[model samples]
Structures are given as C-alpha cells and as structure tokens.
Target: MAETKKYVRIKKASVDGVWYADKIGNVYEVDRENCVSILTKRGIRGLSSVLREDAELIVTEKRPAKVGERVLITVAAPIGKQAYETGDVFVAESLYDPFAKDIRVLGIPDFIDYNEYEVIVDNELKNGEADGMESTYVRKQSEGLDRVAKSLGYVELAKSSLKQNGFIGEVHTFDLLTECAERLREQAQTHKEKIERGYPEFSPVHKSAQARRDEIVEQAKADVERLRENNIRLRTFNISLEVNRKDRSVEAIAKRPKSNRAFYGIAKAAPSDCFNVHIGKAIALRRALGLGVPDEYLNAPQPAEVRVGDVVYGKYSEAYYQLWCEDEIGDVSYEVKIKEIVDGKYRYVGGGYDFIDDADLTIIDDSREGVVGE
Candidate 1:
C-alpha cells in the first residue's frame, strides 16, 4: 500500500460546529464547513464529528511509548490483525513519550482483504499506525528489551480499522522505555536539520530548553570569536579608509581622529587594481593600532629607531603563504619585534625592535607626506 493513501472523503454537514478531537488528541470547535474540510483534508479514519459535550471526552495521553512494547491493535483483517480477527501485534515508534502516541502495526502478509483499510490519521501509517486512543486496547509495556517501534503506516491502517469497529474514542500510551538509541538518533537528526537551516529548536525530551538555548548561544559566541581572531578589521577607530568622491582622493585615517579628518595615510598614485585599496586600508589600520609601519606612510617621518609610535602593516608575504581559509589553515609564519605588543600580538601593537643609531638617524621633511593630493 502507498505510504500516503487517500480514502473516501466523508463529508457530514451535521459535523459543522462540532468539536472533534484531531489525531493528536486536541479538540477543536470547528464549524460544519470547516469540519468537513479538516476531516477531508486529513482524510484519516477514526475521525468523528464530536459535539460540545463530547469536548469533555477529550483526554490527554500522559504515558510515553517504549520500544518493543507489545500492542494488541483491535483492527480489522489485512492490517496485522487477521480478517475477522480482533487483535494484531505492532511496535511503538519512539523510545519515550513522543509528541504523538502513534503506534505501528503490521498487515496480513501475502494476502489481500476483500475490504480495504480506510485511510485515517491523515495517511499516518507504515502499515497499521493508530492514534493514542483508549478503550478495549491492551498495552504491555516494554520490560527493558531491545525492541523497535512499529512503523506508522501499518499502525494507521489498524487505527482506522479500530475506528470502524467502534473503538476510536480516547487513546492512551503505555510501555515507555528509559531511553533508546533510535529515539536519540531521531532527535539528533531533527536538531541537525534545524541547525543547518538556521532554525534550531532544542526541544528534545532528553535535554532541557535552557540547555539547548545555551548550547546555541555558546556556539554562536565561539563562531564570532573565531571570526574576530582570524580576521582583521579596519574600522574608523582602527583606521578609516575613506574615498573622497569630491576630489577622487582615498584618505587613510589612523586611530586618532582629527577635526579636519587628517589624511594620515594616502596614496597619491592611482592603484592599478582594487588590491591597493585594501593595502591602503590595512596601512591605516596598522598605523592606528600602532603596528610597525614606516614613518613615510604615517606622514610623521622619524628616525627608523626603536620607538613607541612606529607602525608596520604586517602580512604573510612568504612564498609558501597561503590565504587563510579558516582557523589559520594557510597562515604564513613571520617574526616581528614585540616591543609594542597590543592584544597579545606584535602585528597590531607597536612592539618591534628597530636598530637605528641616533648619530645619523635623520629624515627629510615632506610637507605633503601624509596628505596625498588627488
């Protein structure tokens, strides 16, 4: 039988404004028009056009299902229960009390029944899956046995049969296992899918909601840390790479902002490609962070001697240096003077050793050194 089988569409006008319990045991006060639409849309057997008084008949299932729990589904023949026979064997799908008390039962093997199993539970069946209805149903709880829950398709068929035989009022759950690996796998798969889709929901019975939320928050925090650690930023505080469209000038401002936005680092020559823009940004950021940058770029040319204000825009320019993919996958190794270390790195802080004897440590004055005229 198809996993999703459509059965006869039962439309009862009298069912309008009737309070009926869905397959999940939830009672809905649906009007006649909506009731027919819902039942037909669900197309599951055992569905009834309940009235307001029947609303009180709605009972919530509390006990959970266990693996290998013996179930005697009182459905018609061809769906695990032999035709004209009363009971059939099936398995529970989940380890503990899942969202639903659906069970899976088998069908009569290698035989066809004159009557067909009605599609109920909205095609929720592996063979004879049923809802958590009580009354005349026997449940032998699992006694710590490695048993798998029955498929829903088979159980649905049986559930429909039970409804047909007048035993579809209230469903109950019994035989809950402590914990099952299969159930864990299901939850894990759901969790994984949600994460991949960026809609993670940690509502597993095994874990607390706070625990799930904490894990997600921690994971996100770790990711942000990783990005910040491995990546470099050139913001205005660090350095501002502003392109003046008025004069087509690219100004690189170091950490200390000026009232006039002094161009601490500017490239007078037009860059061949976009790489120079990045280079300019890096230079400005490195200067702002007090890295060991040449005095020429800082517009404050001083002796190339070990000093506090010297900056150097550092990068992995080695032949074997590969662009960093992630987690320092292809980082080039280099040693810098740690005299002006900041944030535990010499690249961002000005902690480098520059050996320049003061005797001849002199620099030519350039009026337009830092201010690159467009």
Candidate 2:
C-alpha cells in the first residue's frame, strides 16, 4: 500500500549555490518517508536531496456540514437506489440522527456517515466576509443598494422577456423566470438588512490591507490559546505565532514573553497564487519549535494555466480575495464568484460575481503535489 502522506509549504527564499528547485510559498505533498519528485529546470529532481528546514507541514481538516447545506461526496457509498459516487454533490436534509445511524440528503433515500461527505460551504460563517472589507457602514449600505438596483434591472428584463414570450405560448417558462426574479428581489432585501445589521460599527471592518494583516499578529496569540486546548501535550504557553500579510507575502513571528529573541518564518506566494495565512502560521510554528521543515514545501508542482472551477487568488480592483472561476470570459479572462468567509471558512458564495483578467489571477490549489513532472 502507498504510504499515507501530507503537504508542506515553503517559507523562505532559496540560498545561493543550492541546486534544488526550492522556492518560497510552493506546497508539495510528501510520503511518510518525506520524499517527493519535483519538476525543475533540470528536469525531475528528488526533493529530499536538499535541506528541508525552510518548509512547514500543512494540516488539512474538513469542517462538518450542517442541515440544509450542500455537501460533496468524497468517497463512494452505494446503498440500494440511493447510491452515491465520489465527486457527487447534494444538499443535506438532516444532520446525524442517532436513531438513523447516519445523515440524510435531499435526493438520497439512504443515510451517509459524516466521513463520506464534506460541506461545500458553510453558510453561517459567510457573514465574516464583510469584516474584511475596508468600506464603512454607509459605503456598504450603498453597495447593497447598488445590488438592489441591478437586481431591479434584471427583474424588469425578466418581465419584458415574459411579456414577449407569453404571447408565443411559453407561459410556463415565463412564469418560472418571473418567480425567480421575485425571489431575487426578496433575497436582495434580506441581504441589505443583514449587511445593515452587520455594519462596521458593530463588526468592525478592516480599514486597510495592513490593518487586516495586523490581525494575523493577534492570530498568533490566539493560536497559542488554541494549541493549549487541542495540543495539550505540546508546550504552547511559551510560544506565540504572529502572522502578517503584506501584498503576496505572509510573515510569521514566533516568540516567548518579554524575550528579545524571536524566530521568524516568511512565506511568499508565487506571483500567480494568493497569499495564505495558514501556510505562514505552519512554517512559523515549525521554525519556532526548532523542527526541520519538510522537503515538499520547497518543490511543489504549480499550475501553469487557470481552468474552470479552479480556486484562484487575485484582486478585483482594490479588494483582494479568492475566486471560483465559473467560465471563460473571452480568451484571457474568466467570470468568477468571490470566495467569502462563510461561517469562518472561505467558500464560493452566491451573488458576488465579476470578471477577472487571467493576468491578475493565481491558481492556489495544491492537489497535484506528488507528481514528478509537469
């Protein structure tokens, strides 16, 4: 059997005279033996041949799905007529009912265990995204009103289309479109109210990129608290992992209380990828803990082109965020939906849509980690 493995992300710049393809912020998957073959200018090379102290382990965890939310099947679970295959998506109807021994989904008659599927996006955590915006409460209200105005235009178009089509005996289609428009209007109102309630005065949106980056410094302090709760065996009381995002680079500062000495871990995302705070924290923690970094982080495979459904990091004008590419726009751009912080996690949400130039996007997914070459 193949050895179970994990991913590692690089955190530092390459040194002179080194022959390995060690670049900052690239992530690579490695086997239990800490080995991965990477594609380099010199052809494929073993990542283990170089020093691994510059990379840190990446922990991938799945957040639980809630009732009425969407989930993606990660494993095949065939049960009579309600058979589910991997890569399938369905809406969950109910959560684990101790009486049923599984969870229920809309179309499936059978129940599935929690391990079989993962939440597509946690809707509850989506509200935090407004916290990332730099706009004030009044500006947010104006944006919400702008969406309502756009929705009104769409509703008018639907009505005009219905008027033209109703005379042609396509009444059912027109009715459905009209109904959808009504729902869109209702949703817009609801969104406006939600944003009003979640204004900057109450939730406090960041004023600048650096202001947002400063939160990562505090995140290190919080991470220490989290480590104490989960990693009881690890010594966390003396350790602090502070992270800061500057442009495409995320820096982590690890230190002990009142100490002049501190260790730093820095991860710079590639020009085509978004900066990730999680990667920065991992690298910084590893360096602070006096542990050797993993090999794969320095030599992971990178995507050369964007594809539909790819998760990319890029900026839409002044707002920096992740996007889910929905379709190709012309030859050099894509229609994308912004990934929002839904329930404290990043998810591809509805309504936040725009076109992004391919030149401005960076592919961030790292599933192709263990492959030997391009």
Candidate 3:
C-alpha cells in the first residue's frame, strides 16, 4: 500500500506578529493527515484557509549515517593493496564508530574511512522489519560497546609494549603493571561477550552504565550552557580596534551605544613604546562593560614614590545603591603638591586638599621626569 503523506504550504501571515516564524508561501511537512490547523516547528498555526495542500512530501531528517545504507566516497583513501577513489559507492555492512565515520563494507579487507562520504540512500524498512527506531537504539548500544572494546584494545597494545621493553623500575612497579594488564584483558573479554549478546532492552539496566550515560548527558549540557554564556559575552563586548596616535602617547577608546541616545565611553592611554592597541581596546571595553580587567593588563610595576605631575586616584566616597552600601568609588583623579607638613602628615595645595595619608593615594601615571616631590 502506498504511504499517505501530508504536506502544507502556509498561505497567510500569523495574526500574532510572528511573521518570521513562517513566511506567507513556504512549504512545510505536517504529521497529521486531516486537520483544520497545524503547528509547525517554527510555532506557526492558523485555520485551514491559511494552508495550501502541497503535493511534494518533504522528509527532512538530520541524523548520522547508519549501517546497511548506500554511501558515495567523497575522499580517496588507499587501503590494503587497492585504493577507494572518490565517487565510489558502497553499501555499509557494519558501523565501526558511533558517528558512522568508519565502517566495514563488503569487498573491503580493512575498515573504510567513511567520514568523507555522502549518503546515496538510507536503508529502507521492510514490511515485516523490526521497528526502525528500536533497531537504531540497539545499533547505538552496539556502537558504544565497540568504542569500549577499541579503548581496551589500545590498553592491551600498551601493556604488550610495556612488557616487551622490560621495565627498569622496582619489583613493585612491575607487579602493578601486571595487575593493570590483567584488568585490561578482563575488561576486553567482558566487552566482547556483551557484543555477542545483542542489546535487547531499551536502556541499560546496570546502575554503572546508567550513571555513565547520565554523566555524559550532564557534561554535554554543561558544554552547551558555557557556549551560550560565551556567545552573550561576545555580543555584549563587541568592540572595534582603533588607536589615537599622539606624539609619544597612544590612546584607546571604547564606545558602547545605548538605546537612550547616550553611550558608554572608556579610554586608556600608554606610552607609544609600551602600548599594544589590541590589549588597550580589550581593557577599555571590559571597563566600559563593568567587567574585571585581567591582571596582565596592569603589568608595569607601580612606583614606590609619588612625584609632582603624577596622576593619582583616591578612594573618594562610598556608593549606596537602594539604601545598601555598595563598593567604594575610585574614578576621581587628583594631582596635588605638598603645601605643608605637620604631625607627620602632609597637606597638599589642591581643591579641598587636607592632611591625607600616603596610603590613601595611588600613583597611576608618573610621566613628568624632572618635577620634584616636596
């Protein structure tokens, strides 16, 4: 009996202002046969009038190539006495890897590198075939076992090499190696037995295997979460590289435009001899985004003594946000001179300069060469 497949082409835009989700005249595959409306993967749904019956059924499936499928080699690889050239088509007999990138095919003495191959056709399901989904699950289980067996093979190879090159270590070291070798052999035998006894259950019943599967899933989720965070950071810190060149000094400015017709401006300056435009831009951008600057950016050793014309920063005031005391604000810069010295404290000649301790000031730029500190 011919299969009855349903296809749809959207004829009108959605009323919910989600036009981008589905265009006015794009075809899509639907699971239902006779429905008045359909919800697509893009989240578009409406009345029957919004859809037009499409004659061509689109079967879009994204999955790794499986065994028993026809594939065309895109890359030429030499194996044994003969070479498999590009454009050679073959039916894969067995998958040697989880991704189906390495396979064993008929008429090939060695495993073929199937990574550089295009799928000619997928294996068709027969009338009395075992459930396709169930077969796929079993195949995946077998592939995982194959991987474990391959790893054990490598361990056995290493053990053989270690025994061949007689150990120069003490007696206990040799004993340890022997114990590891025995364990590896036992593991290999166990994996071989499991492969012979085909996987019948939907999921692994053993606690150790289930825990390992959960660990893999959790690790994958962590990797995806980290990538998402990194993408956000990249978008937030989008910066352009430019340098303002002034005689003996270079300045890097970072600008971030806000929706309120204003922008965040941050600038950093360095002597032309020691300036790296890229690092300067990164530092300025981080500061503009209120992020922590790397320690390597502040590489120069700060001077022990404060001199005249030296630019300095002071912990001027404490900030309070929402009635709660926040961090200390240190953006205010000051340049002062010693006007008088009393009670082992120095008073400077500047705006509101008073008897301030030396520890309260941090010298940031010491450029003036001949000026003396009094």
TM-scores of the candidates are 0.16, 0.28, 0.19
For 31-134, candidate 3 gives per-residue lDDT tens digits of 54311123343335542222111121233222334654555564557575765765455555566755456776545667776455555532221111133434
Inter-residue clash pairs, candidate 3: none
Which residue runs does candidate 3 get wrong by more than 4 Å? 1-130, 168-174, 201-374
Q: Kindly report which residue pairs in candidate 2 clash with one another.
A: 124-343, 125-342, 125-343, 125-344, 126-342, 126-343, 220-241, 272-362
lDDT for model 3, please. Answer: 0.44
lDDT of 3 at 71: 59
The CA lDDT of each predicted structure is 0.32, 0.47, 0.44
Error of 3 at 121 (Å): 35
The most accurate candidate by lDDT is 2
Error of 1 at 161 (Å): 18
Worst 10 residues of 3 by lDDT: 47-56
Clashing pairs counted in every model: 46, 8, 0
Worst 10 residues of 2 by lDDT: 121-130
TM-score of 3: 0.19
Tell me how candidate 1 scores on lDDT: 0.32
Best by TM-score: 2
